[model samples]
Target: MTYIGRFAPSPSGPLHFGSLIAAFGSYFQAKSQQGQWLVRIEDLDPPREMPGASSLILNTLESYGLHWDGSVIYQSQRHQRYQEQIDSWLASGLAYYCQCTRKQIKQGGGFYLGTCRHKSQLTPEGCSVRLHVKQAIEQFTDQKHGVITIPHQLAQEDFIIKRRDGLFAYNLAVVLDDIDQGVTEVVRGADLIEPTGRQINLYRYLNQPEVSYIHLPLALDEHGNKLSKQNHAPAVDTHCAKETLIKVMLFLGFTLPDDFQSASIEQMIEWGCQHWSLQQLPNSLASSTL
Candidate 1:
């Protein structure tokens, strides 16, 4: 089978160290296997998206000599596609409208409690779509985290597929994107491990072929907060592009050569892709160095 991987990043901020590590790791992994690497803009979270951040991310990747196989797929432009999928799920009774609000759910221990599971009528407003979740799946090995399972309550809770405001949820977007892109391997930040089982359930429900998932240790701040836009992680310095690339390569488990330490961005990418190794990556978080 032809291997395919992706580096789907939410454009809430410029590509920071953490973001760079994910991009470089996935890009090189695909190249090492002589597979295709694609980029996708996970812009489903409208409120948090930063203006111009997506364009800047693409430009930054190019500066570091990490180009994708085809056109970058943006989620914003694919609303109609997501709606069609949701309608299909609804028609098959695989999903239903959820009317629970924040206040009610908090009292219900974070589980949806199936409050609206039997709502006879679908309201035009004040409802979210939820995938009827199932029982705990048996142990499945994460390429890095060893055997894994979603916490029982989380795994069994009927999770949201569309928010109350009618926007398509991340869970729906990710699974559909992978299926549409023919991505066989999903290499991404480990912070998303909790959601893997949920997405797996989505795939099974949709009758889509399962994809291999490898969650890399996240790059965290000293306080151990995952480096992200919400945490105020600084934007990457495109001026320090070459040096930044070296740090990310090292973080992804590549040893830099002393002679080529002063090499240009293209040379570093050439070397990085030639030496991608999944074994060198740690199962825990990689803290960012300033």
Candidate 2:
């Protein structure tokens, strides 16, 4: 099978260094294998999305020479696809409605007690849809991180697939789209490692082929917090694209040749693809300033 990979980013804010590193890692992983690379705008949450952020992200990727293989996919326009999966899950005995609030779950030791799993009468007014996780996905091997195991207690909880506000949950939408796009590998940051088991279970629940995963080390600030839009991480300077790419490469633990330091964006990417290997990547977060 042909290799396929993606860099799916939420439009909560502009593309920051953390996001750039993720895009860079995924891009190299796909291109190095002569595979198709796709970009997905995860614009499912309207309230968190900033106007024009999606366009800016696409432009930034292009400016940095991380071109996608086909038309960029917008999750907002694919509501029908997400809805169909949810409807199917509800019809089958795979998923059910959840009416428990955050406070209720917290009171029950912070994990869902599956309170509504047996309730037949559920009103859509304030109910969310949750996947009934019957089996525990204790462990799965990551291409880079090696044997990653979810705690048994956390693996058996019925997690939400759709929010009460009618927005498709990240875990649900991502799995469905990965299946729809025929993505063979998922390469992103280590911050999303915890969600991998849930997504894997969803793949099994839907009876689809589970994609391979490789999570790059996270870029953290001096304080040890991961750089994120929620923490107000500044957007990357695409005008200095080459310099930015160098930072990402160094963070990923590559020693560039002195001659290649002055290479253009396209040259850098080509060189990166030729020289990059997942085994060389560091497993721990490296501190850096924007």
Compare the candidates by lDDT and give the number of the best one.
2
For candidate 2, write residues 1-290 as lDDT tens digits: 99999999999989999999899999889988999999999999999999999999999999999889988898998889888888898888788898899999999899887899988799677999999998878898888878988887788889999999999999998999889998999998888888888999999998899999998887877777889999998999977888888999988778999887778889999999998898878764334443
Clashing pairs in 2: none
Clashing pairs in 1: none
Q: Backbone clash tally for model 2?
A: 0
- Per-model lDDT: 0.83, 0.89
User: What TM-scores do the predictions have?
Assistant: 0.94, 0.97
The 10-residue segment of model 2 with minimum total lDDT is 281-290
Model 1 C-alpha lDDT per residue in residues 1-290, reported as the tens digit of each score = 99999999998889888888788888888888899999999999878888999999999888888889989999999999999988888887878988888889998786767788878597648889888776544455776667876677777788889999878999899999999999998988777777888888878887888888777767878887888878998888888887787778777777778876778888888887787788888755444443
RMSD of each: 1.7, 1.4
Predicted structure 1: lDDT: 0.83
